[model samples]
Each structure stands twice: as C-alpha cells, then as structure tokens.
Target: MFPKLDPILHSELRLAVMSILAGVESAEFSYIKKQTGATSGNLSVQIDKLSAAGYISVEKGFKGKVPCTTCKITPAGLAAFENYVNSLKEYLI
Candidate 1:
C-alpha cells in the first residue's frame, strides 16, 4: 500500500509555496505571489491554511510604512515536507 500524501501540501500552489520557502530563510508575501503567480486573495487563503497547520509562520509588520508579510517554514514543516516526499516514492516503486 502506498503511503498517504499530506493533504495540506497536496495543492499545487501550497506545494509550490513550501518548495520555495524550503530554500530560503524567509520570503515576503510579494515574493511568493510573484513566484507562484497567484492572486493575492488565493495566496492569502493558502497562507492561512499553512499557518493554521503549524507548517509555517506568518508575520505581519510594516516595512518603512508599507505593510509587509513574511513566511518561514517551521521545523515541523520541513519534517512534514520530507515525509510527504518519502511517501510519494511509494508510488514510484
């Protein structure tokens, strides 16, 4: 039997977000929006889901009077992502 994939990271946009965050210390909302080419509304919703899952941390602050949001993957997130990848291999075998 194949291992189950994480439902949270299963979405294309969410997976893409995680993949990018995995390679960086943190990323601004604009950066992720640009990289993913996702609309602000859609991306915000996904970000909320990831944050709620404790997979990522979302920080809201101001950057010289500009509202800025940054996201960072938590240790739990990295571990979950790793597990998700390992589980995916079950299908390839």
Candidate 2:
C-alpha cells in the first residue's frame, strides 16, 4: 500500500511550520510564533521535534546583546511536505 501522510506531519501546527519554512530563507522562533499564532512554549516544542527529525535546522546566537534563534527547512523537510500533499491528492481524486 502507498504511504499516507504521517500523523506527526499532518498536525495543523507542524504543517504550518513546514509551509512557512518552505517559503523563507530562515525565520526566527519568535517570528514563527507570531505568524502561526502559537504560544511560545508550543512553538518551541514543535520546532524541536522537527529539528530532531532532521527536517529543519535550528541555530542559536545573539543579536547585539539579545538572544536569537532561527530555523530553516531542510531538503528532506521540503520533499516530505510536497509528498504529503501529493498523498492527499490521491484521496481527493
């Protein structure tokens, strides 16, 4: 049987995360939280999961004296999101 969209990837927050990551060079953690309308704690947890899965990269640094964290989607992540939509298209047809 063909693979379906993974449950982990199909969640609203995760899908939104991947979609936004797909568009930009990189985004800050706070930026993602703002755009997704997710709480900071929730966004942090979801991003960590994506990072562990090798779907995205997380970088921690400082901007001036303040702390900063950024995220970018990996090639694997982009491919997975595309494939997930394709999987759903099969059901839609």
TM-score of each: 0.97, 0.92
User: Whose TM-score is greatest here?
Assistant: 1
lDDT per residue (tens digit) for residues 19-83 in model 1: 99999999999999999999999999999999999999999999999999999999999999999
Query: What is the lDDT, from 0 to 100, of the residue 1 in candidate 1?
Result: 75
Which prediction has the highest lDDT against the true structure? 1
Q: lDDT of all the models against the reference? A: 0.97, 0.90
Give per-residue CA lDDT, model 2, range 1-93, as digits (tens). Answer: 566777768889988999899999999988898899999899989999988888899999999999999999999988888888899888787
The 10-residue segment with the lowest total lDDT in model 1: 84-93
Model 2, which residues run further than 4 Å from truth?
none
The local distance difference test score of model 1 is 0.97
Off by over 4 Å in 1: none
